[model samples]
Target: MSSGSALIPLDRALARLLDGLGPVAAETAALPDAAGLVAAETLHAPRALPVRPLALRRGIAVASADLVGATPHAPALLPSAPPVVLGGDVLPEGADAVLPADAAATSGPFHEIGQSAYPGEGAVLPGTDLTDGAVIVAAGAPITAEAVLALQLAGIAELTVRRPRIALMGDAAGAEAAWLKARLARAGCAVTDAAPADLVLHLARDPAAVVAGPGLALQPGGDAALLVDGTSRTLVLAPRADALVAALFALVFPVVAVLQGRRLATVARALTRNMASQVGLADLALLRHTPEGWEPLGVGRVTLMAILAADAVAILGPESEGAAAGAPIAAIPLQEPFDPR
Candidate 1:
């Protein structure tokens, strides 16, 4: 209310936030700690996943050629079978197969191979688990649980990834600020207190103060602003407790996309009722996904009740006039992915 700057479009505001910003420098992280981050570049296996043949069962390793023609009727007697290897153990140098406990019998200090064995019987041949030259993780892929599993299986302990570091500039102890911190982390940001962070989120609610930043055109959050200095971008969020969340998706989330090179997930849902929006300003619609479709809770400065009742949000861009009943819209999901509802 104090700044006389003209209100800027939401997209323009986001673009200003990204004016000179780029993905932060890549850092090496242990595989276990890399989850929820984006890979800096495509990664290939450093070596074969399992460098040697692997025993798939608890049994004696054997040279398959030596067991040909051997059977219960005419067992091939041997001084000893190849060295014993358990599940997950590497087959010994002289062994090409794993003879199950039932396949071998001991007779007068001699190990008898009673069943024939093939070269790869009961064993995973070398490079079969994951080839030596296969791609371990593609560029820009999220370091998810599955991706981490494959990396670990490939004997990789670390990865190079891009994790934007953000500095919180406002009421870090306030409930709204804490919520913002958590959501930012889920978007693959490292929230911290000091300098060197790639971005800063300044939370303020001082109505008497005149600040210099972008003229935010978002309803319920138009008072917020964006401050740019050198390579540092600070997002000033004047979040009334009820407007905290709506303001974030409206102003802050898009910057994450610019840095990480990926978009946050959204689910398509049909609106349950008509939702009208101003043609000139961006609108934030809080919603509850019901059995039939999305039930609009409230738009603009929604109530605490509206926030609690909501499970997702739909942002009507600056160019839009909102949607009619049964109109499908892309919404940012606020609940866990496994919600039964």
Candidate 2:
């Protein structure tokens, strides 16, 4: 169902959705649960990693000066003062280097070294991995698995992050709504119908219908329109569930990022099929991953079959023309793979 209204550019539509919007309030989340959420504040390392100097190998700790003349033929005998150490053990006092077990022969309490030992060799010094007060995660940065690992290594148990409360109101029984709800939930947003929503998305079939309050209204059929103020902002999309879901993801992802106080990341992949431009209107075409590469499904041919066979969606901007086959284009992959076969 195409709306008679002129199509708004994709970038312009997103800008409208982001107008007057701010980041959601920060809340404390456990480190494990903080993945995918935006950091509300800068996280600093409370203490240095490793905590102290650690041996890197199983060997004898000794003064580097004693091993200056060590060679394969004339191996230097280490003083029977310091004790042997294993990997990850703390170096003994007054020992500045470690002679690896392979390079040293143990005889009673003394060890024979065949190689020169350099100070700080075969050992990790304190603060080498992470220093105290260093920024682990900057504000507005996404908490990734690597970030989580770093935080855990730095002994961080919890973190403050922006968890936006998004309200999903529409055809609750419809597959599109359910899919959108799950996607939003996976994006770290709290999806509910309770009052005081940071943003509301009303999914309707009618393009002219108005919804209460100021929010976005998505109409799946034809050309999409994003209206502001008390007026309804309806997005006309294809009737097929796959088409509708692709359209919803393309429109809502940026809005969620704006609300979370983070910039949306753009990812592009090679397109397997040709995609024609819509001139003024922005188009999101579903894609399927084949052995050849990513194949874009035609917009007019979008159906449950096409959706089921697709794994991603390629977005064509308003300013650009159609893309030829095998051209790299921006795309978003479906969270779960769809197998049409």
Candidate 3:
């Protein structure tokens, strides 16, 4: 039987994509917390992790050799020793390890004269827990709290990661108004609204704005993607920005019929499939202010319609369009644009 759409289950789709693409990383969040996030590269141990054995409990320090001579009947008297606190490093010279206060009779000195003590029987061995330059975690591994702790223990300073970024355009567009820029910045992304943006966001209050943004965004060939989301609607499409308006008119609808004074269907079948591995959309801004009035103009028409639809769209606009709406887009050729908003 033929299905209406070749739809793979969401879980199945994710699994396939993950398997093919491998682990994707976000920017390096601080260690001791950003566990589960993919490591940018291999991180080496700063010095030696757990450089020394931490005492498990409060106790007295004693040398394994010192206890060699003790016996049950004629027990050697142990010399008076200071109390060792938990986490204290046991010195290797005289004390092989520490004896828990509860386990030893500290009231009297322990003295052994004739017997021998076993090696490593009473103390922590150096480099047993972990050694220096050990690969604590690998690249593409998910960061977890435990991993964060391990990184901290390993003494990692700065971590390299794929930082999230968003480019903005729309009816009410402004470089400062880019929510993703602000959000990512707050979340520790060195953000920029420049072209070749990691992502693009078509943030307008209406569908019309979305259309305009897509028209503008789909210019740099069909390689970069577009995402439009707001008010229970999200459209992932790719439109050829480089394609002339006349070419689109020829492809989607018959301009000749319209010229002949026939009002054809307003909706055109001009959609480009999403070639993105990951697509995310969010209405972080629940706007309610009704626009007084706006006449559709140039690319702004899409933004205006969105205002009428009471919905918004975010598109991964062209990398060049970083200036305020009216201003010119940048000159750089945008690549790998992102729209994680």
Give the best candidate by lDDT: 1
Which parts of model 3 have CA positions greater than 4 angstroms off? 1-37, 69-71, 77-83, 88-94, 102-124, 167-196, 203-209, 212-341
Give a tens-digit lDDT track for model 3, residues 247-267: 122111121122112222321
- CA lDDT of each prediction against the hidden true structure: 0.76, 0.67, 0.36
TM-score, structure 2 vs. true: 0.70
**Per model, how many backbone clashes are there?**
0, 6, 37
What candidate 2 gets wrong by more than 4 Å, as runs, is: 1-3, 6-16, 46-48, 57-59, 62-65, 81-86, 96-110, 119-121, 131-134, 169-178, 201-240, 267-274, 277-281, 287-295, 300-314, 317-341
Ordering by TM-score: 1, 2, 3
RMSD of each: 4.6, 6.1, 18.2
Q: Least lDDT summed over 10 consecutive residues: which range in candidate 3? A: 332-341
Q: How accurate locally is residue 109 in candidate 3, as Cα lDDT from 0 to 100?
A: 49
Candidate 2 lDDT (Cα, 0 to 1) = 0.67
Give residue 203's lDDT in candidate 3 (0 to 100): 40
Q: Comparing 2 and 3 by lDDT, which wins?
A: 2
Q: What TM-score, computed on C-alpha atoms, does each candidate reach?
A: 0.79, 0.70, 0.42
Report the alpha-carbon TM-score of model 3 versus the true structure.
0.42
Q: Give the CA lDDT, 0 to 100, for residue 180 in model 1.
A: 79
TM-score for model 1? Answer: 0.79
